[model samples]
Target: SMETNKRNYFGISQGLIKFHPKQQYCLTAECIEAAAAVLSKINQSVDPCDNFYRFACDGWIYNNPIPEDMSNYGVYPWLRHNVDLKLKALLEKPISKRQDSEAVQKAKILYASCMNENKIEKADVKPLLSILRHSPFRWPVLESNIGPEGLWSERRFSLVQTLATLRGQYSNSVFIRLYVAADDKVSNRYILKLDQASLSLSSREDYLENTTEAKSYRDTFLQFMVDTAVLLGANASRAESDMKSVLKLEVKIAEIMIPYENRTSEVMYNKMNISELSAMIPQFDWLGYIKKVIDTKLYPELKDIGPSENVIVRVPQYFKDLFRILENERKKSPHFCLNSFRGVFPCGQQESLVSGTFISSKQFYCLLQIHSPLSLV
Candidate 1:
């Protein structure tokens, strides 16, 4: 089974899977089933005690799963996370006054290419225009505004390994407490340690399967999910939209996490802010840690911090500082993005998300500052 599973790497994993891959109708149940089985296997192998994201999926892909509207393989969770930050920043301001940020422009261009029918269309669009028309839902905006693209052209991609399989292929993945002194002295003595059981939950990378029909159904499902939530009496506060937002946020962050397939520890170590995360261990640099955890073949693109370079996402200050370092480390790596479903913003941030904000939620989206926890241990 190990030999067979290892041999099935169809080179399909090399790049993102666009829906219209030359063949207009190349989706097959066999392929989706294969993907599902892989996911099921990975889930099964996941230790119930561990953090699902760590073992269930790789760092980059785990952080950036595919979106639901269409089977977009390119737009990832991290980039989307960046997109979300730009959007949230805009939304925080008066709608009429919201202006385009660099990340917003990048998202629009990237999103347009993934979902647009015509290659030449400008992806830049107003938030209201986007919500009313181009939302993951299939409804036309207002009366006669037809969206520029059809949902049929989306793409999907994922990776799954059963518990039985993962146990055999690799050592269990876990998180451990760390202390990095100014001298760069690494001590495994005190505090937490990396363990496989920490990442036990199985993750679903692509929102849904890659079939054309499945894609359409999913678009409609997500559309209704948002629309229904909108019509049901509620206020449009970020708090109410929490449920869908967090779900979307998790997958978005996973896209970035997945690429460092085996670098869970290194990714966690490099992400300086991750250590500061509410429940996370002290003094961990997740982004750098992830870089170190994965083999060179699956190394992540660590960006560099520079005055001229725009930050991809509005990460916590710790992360903002480390982004440049991560970028520098990943300078030579290829860039891949994932597209996720976008719906009418739900009324308020959902409760589920608020509660779990400390989880994967923080990885992509920003925290509401539930409490003013002072920095450091």
Candidate 2:
């Protein structure tokens, strides 16, 4: 009887241990769902040892087809799309005095302004024309009616001054892009850096290469520029002729530019003061340009920018070649063909101004608050 009781007690203890929550070999619903998601992306038919990428991603590729508008689709773009949706939701949320930070409130206001299509449609091109009527923004191409014989003086059109105005007030990078960045060597102090401006096409190769695709791209770009000029009230025949000249100039620029593969840090990192740079490329006033750009009403303290200031010229050869091209263009067309070219490809507009600069949404919102209060309306 004692032996029987002991056996029964031992059996009861074993059953209790098997039924315990910690001891049970079962997964939660959340874990099972997560596992299902991971498995769905994997193709069991594809051997991992032979082709790991295919084994892991074949099923996913089969499930997600590339959209008609997209050139390609991938995980990064998917993640980016998700992030954009989240950002849109956040930005669209109603501004609450209790919950919103200053930056958030400002962002909400800016987003709201952007979304108000009715206000935008009513305003039309008046706002843009108002901006263009300003001194530096007065496009020479559009100023045919202003000057004697419908010709603006080349003397008044200072390349350095124009570049400064476009870069500083308008945030346009025409040919040379100038910005303050941490010294590559020092990595502590900031110094002005000069780089080749981006082209309409993706690469210099697109302009210089003699291929079917390159020719197609060049033709398309020329047509686009001509159309833009026509839309902006330029004479169609003159616009076509001028845009062709601009395209040729860009091609020359592409020919001189250092290819991406050859542009090593050691090769491109040529540091010099503004005076030395001026001596090297005497066509443009480096010191005056820098001073004008930095000495803004917003930053009154940055008034003493001088020739002695050091700068990093990333593409020295490109600048040398560019100045030569400018000299040739100046000799060929006294009024500066490029000056007229600006009307066809006007900078300082929302689209052109935003390129080549990296700014977070919050930072951009803050900038809008400081510079153009109307942008936040």
Candidate 3:
């Protein structure tokens, strides 16, 4: 058994990383892997009554099909783009080769039918049923009715509600508290300990009022664009004058948007890659976090989660300094600092404020300047 304190420690750490889209993928993947290992162990072990394997397997299925499209929606260009690539490769594989081959095949058929993407749509229910029947354990007993729904009940929580519960529980337990919301079910409360108490509807209405400020910022940014357009349009003799105006606008807008709190919290947002996030937060550990939270000690077989990389954050110099300050605060007090920016970067609200930063951009290009001393232009 893992140390008891490890559970609380990881639960909080994972909660903090959950705020960023990339980190959440990493953490969830870790859970699936741990659960898989536990399941394998139970199937091989002489003892089948072990409750640990049962819980681990059920938890895996509960959050299975991490809904890749919905998982990293509206995220920064680098992380969002990478996750899609990884998921595409994962789904492209034939079912016989998948980690949970039975379910993977079923998922492919279901998704193909619903979306009709022209990909493989054949479903094999035999392997799926075989796994279900052999498990000897049943879900719904563990609060997840995620097996073959026909064999279970159609009354299972909507995917949105189920995801919300998972997100909430994850936030409450981990270091990174992400802002996850499914359009189907928007919760009245933020799940992390920082905002355990429910916020009033009126208070949320008041917060949405930031749209006015957002619009003001948008107008200022638009002017900067107009000035750039003029700079490019101007004759060579007038180019310098227009260019200077554009530069001036750039400085002004940078000063206006991208607040201090958001800038300062870099480590929370960008430092750790998904793998590192899994290691940093103890709550998602193979032994302790799973054992305590799910009432099972056995770890699941690790799932093959993809897009193995850290989230890329383009931090301006100002935000870099802020990130250092916030990092220190996080080291000192984990729970207090994770959700400090809650009022500002709340759920479903765009946190991408500055223009230079492409934390939320889609069309990104990298300019590679390969300098060779032997080359002459």
Candidate 4:
């Protein structure tokens, strides 16, 4: 059976490449292997002029079948699989030498913690629920008993401070995204850049399109959001109502958002001083927000950041439109819009196990984002 399996490749793979009579080169192992590799993957049955891809790749396809877990497969995937296997072996190895860095050791510990599924299952939602019970993160839809810290405080909420805390502490991005990178125009030095962020749903079409399937997707998405919130101790009626507003807000946002096709390098290069940015978009505190997000401990040299700091504002129009929408929403219902901003419901880790039944497709991917984040769902 083993020999039969090996015989599945092209006949050229079974033999070595013979040298011409006048050739002087030795038949080294590396040379032989390299020659065999090119020959092995050629499908002699197919003509190269017609369906050259199949002619070249047929042997490889027959030899290396796609894995059950993967949606697609290729040579790169096979190479990556090998690299991951090697990395896994390295990470699993115990730290024995003083030469090993602290980061390396910590990575191993994290890998071990992630691998301990029994402990994860036992601990379950307790780890994430504790995070949700705090200020700025408190979901109003949650039952007061389970969410014992009382409801979110509107009086204490500051949009700038909340944005900073969410970014600094949990590494979440909501309306605005702030990150450091080499200036797009001036390719030498790095500078902070502000841009628009993602929404809860994967596709923009789910929010934008008016088709039956699109409407169905939105309904499915909304129902999923409601179900996740209800599962997290929120009343079904309240969750459905609250989530409707949240979804409505997101749809408005989707309408205003600039599509991907328009975001060219030249179009996005709006480099200006932090003072200019504040003057332009007075709704947000530019200096204060950036200062709060930056970790002085890690970036001690960046302690000198101030109003004069030149930063790139990618989507200036979006910010203006966003605040205008928010201003209108606030005028209409003061507490309602602010409350919606803080109504964050993170999907639990073990949704199925927690409810003692499979949670199904409602357990959406991390667009509410990877963990407990301060983004709209």
Candidate 5:
């Protein structure tokens, strides 16, 4: 019986073996290169069981020292750097107007524009000043003679429209930040979410700290803002005053912001409909704001956005205080609210930026991970 069972198993194995493709040594260039890469990064002399990390990484550490600019080095960054080089090479390839796809041509055009320092310098800050001179974005710091559009009008001020337009057109979100993220409760579903956002300074600690270093950093930040406004045809005194207020407003936002430690997943998951959001915070138009920002022209399906549309309010308290501050601040300085809207004005700041820095910063853009509405990150 044992002999018969062994024979049966052998027969099955033999049948399956004949059906499988014959294995051969892969000596292709790609296979050899991949093998060489692994071989190069391993120290066979060191027993892996005794010292696994060193055995695996010693050769890699010896061969690839960290670059001067990077604070840390690893496989991920190395792969990213290689990918960027490949992308740069592809984008640098000459565009064939008739041959290339529209998307490829557009990418090539953008890459060419970024590389063109002379053309960018020639244009100067005119593009930026032109944007600021327009309705809703007319920076109050700039006087009437700044452009044909003249000074920002108090009559045209609508908090809902201004906030919405900033996000919609310029891709800048002021008080209310919108994102499309997977629901915590329903992992498979993606939902629109609103949160407090856009502070001038990166760190909330910068606003809260009373240390000398914090104070110095704040002063320098305020000075930078004032200098930027003055460079774009704003009066020095008025620029200083308005920017000081802007800085203060940012600090207030930082104060109200929920600390990272406090922002557990459960705390942030305040799911509700648009109507509930409006009822909760009656000062601002919740439905109008979301509708304005979402370009129904492009996303025609989104045109049916109504009070019943679902959304997650990440920080309800922040919105409550934010509207309260904006309401009080607007009464004092009617046109000043838009100043925060144009905080991240994309324009020529320094001569170096116009000359060589813009080209250098193209590398930064390639590395940047922006959390835009489109990205949903």
Candidate 6:
């Protein structure tokens, strides 16, 4: 009787009313806001069916013009800028709380030191001069007594020793870079690896090419080196002449180096023991240099890295060519300074601060662990 009453109703005659539950809209306020934000970036005028990228990104491209200082701008650079800003803010914060981590405190100190331009300026060349006056870094170009009468002693200038000092102390990789890394073949095990050092210019192509840009780059670099030498007490004329030789030597090195394109994993991966490597390239005392580097007070446990140690020679040909170049250069010039100018350069001080921050933070963590709260209590 109820069903008959419903069927006899006025709307039910035209089948306008149904018993099914009403359909509900699923979108929330937040969902609608997000959709609006996405839609705002799209150019409705440009048909997405014809050119999707232009339709999607036209509004964004119009809004964010590239800066004058930047050659290009992209998502990665924007992300990096945001991250750097966050890091700067974090580092600028003062260490007040007693419970604050030692690592955070050390990072704040390092950042403060870096930011203290007044102190750095006051210290001036003194810090660099101190480093230059030290054993291996006492560059003959910088020394007042270096000339025809008081030439640099070849006996005292051991390439191996100088290289070791640069690599170990300053972390400056000159002609060759030696470091411990995971074995390519056996990813689990760590082994020593040697590779060609980076060039002053961006690439070997910069030196090899005869283009106008290449020539300009090379000339500017030469002039810079000459100026650096002159600033460090070298006679202007002599510095110019000597730096020309160094530049020429670098060009030759560039010629011999394996091009990055050709240096595939298979081509570069040549694993051999230190003894075998020494036999292959006998110009330098590889074992002795490695021993000296590892035997430092910082790493007393690594004193006896010997000939039996396995090493991966990334570029065997580069080493062979490098030794030949070294021999020729050694015979030609008495003073062999490799990137010694870096010590006095103002840029180097800033670079050291930035580069050493991570290392300093790690050292702080180690010290904190050694003197933990339990130990202190």
User: Against the true structure, whose TM-score is highest?
Assistant: 5
RMSD of each: 24.4, 12.3, 26.6, 9.7, 9.3, 13.2
Q: How well is each residue in 1-377 modelled by candidate 1, as lDDT tens digits?
A: 86455435422442234343675542599888877655653443444334556445543455456543223444353455576676545434432325766544544444434333343234333343444333233221122233454222222211011121122222222222122222112554322222222211123333334656544443443344454334432233422343244335333343433332554443344322332442232233444443343334433333331223211111233233333333442343221111112212221122122112213443122322211111111
lDDT for position 166 in model 3: 31
Measured by TM-score, how close is model 2 to the native structure?
A: 0.66
| lDDT of each candidate versus the true structure | 0.33, 0.68, 0.33, 0.67, 0.73, 0.68
- Full-model lDDT, candidate 3: 0.33
Clashing pairs in 4: none
User: Which regions in candidate 2 have their CA more than 4 angstroms from the true location?
Assistant: 1-90, 96-115, 143-151, 339-377
Which regions of candidate 6 fall more than 4 Å away from where they truly are?
1-89, 96-104, 145-151, 349-377
RMSD of 5: 9.3
Model 6 lDDT tens row, 31-107 = 88987867777787885556779888887677667643232456675665566567666666778669668867876
RMSD of 1: 24.4
Query: Whose TM-score is higher: candidate 1's or candidate 5's?
Result: 5
In candidate 3, what are the lDDT values of residues 52-168, reduced to their tens digit? 455335534443433322222222534545755665555545567436566556555443343442321243333233332222211222112224432323243222232233333
Model 5, TM vs. native = 0.72
1-377, model 5: which lDDT tens digit per residue? Answer: 97677667756775675565774557899999998999799886775556879889988988999764333478987887787778777777899988898877877776677567688689887877777766767777887448657577888767777778877875677878886778889999988999878565546787789987567657767777787878777888988888889888888879999887988888998999999999999998889998898888888998999999999999999999988887888888866544443434653122112111232455435323121232531
**TM-score attained by model 6:** 0.68
Sort all candidates by TM-score, best to worst: 5, 6, 4, 2, 3, 1
**Candidate 3, superposed: residue stretches over 4 Å from native:** 1-75, 89-94, 97-165, 168-377
Query: Which candidate number has the best lDDT?
Result: 5
Candidate 5, 70: how far from true, in Å?
11
lDDT for position 315 in model 6:
94
The TM-score values for the models, in the order shown, are 0.20, 0.66, 0.21, 0.68, 0.72, 0.68
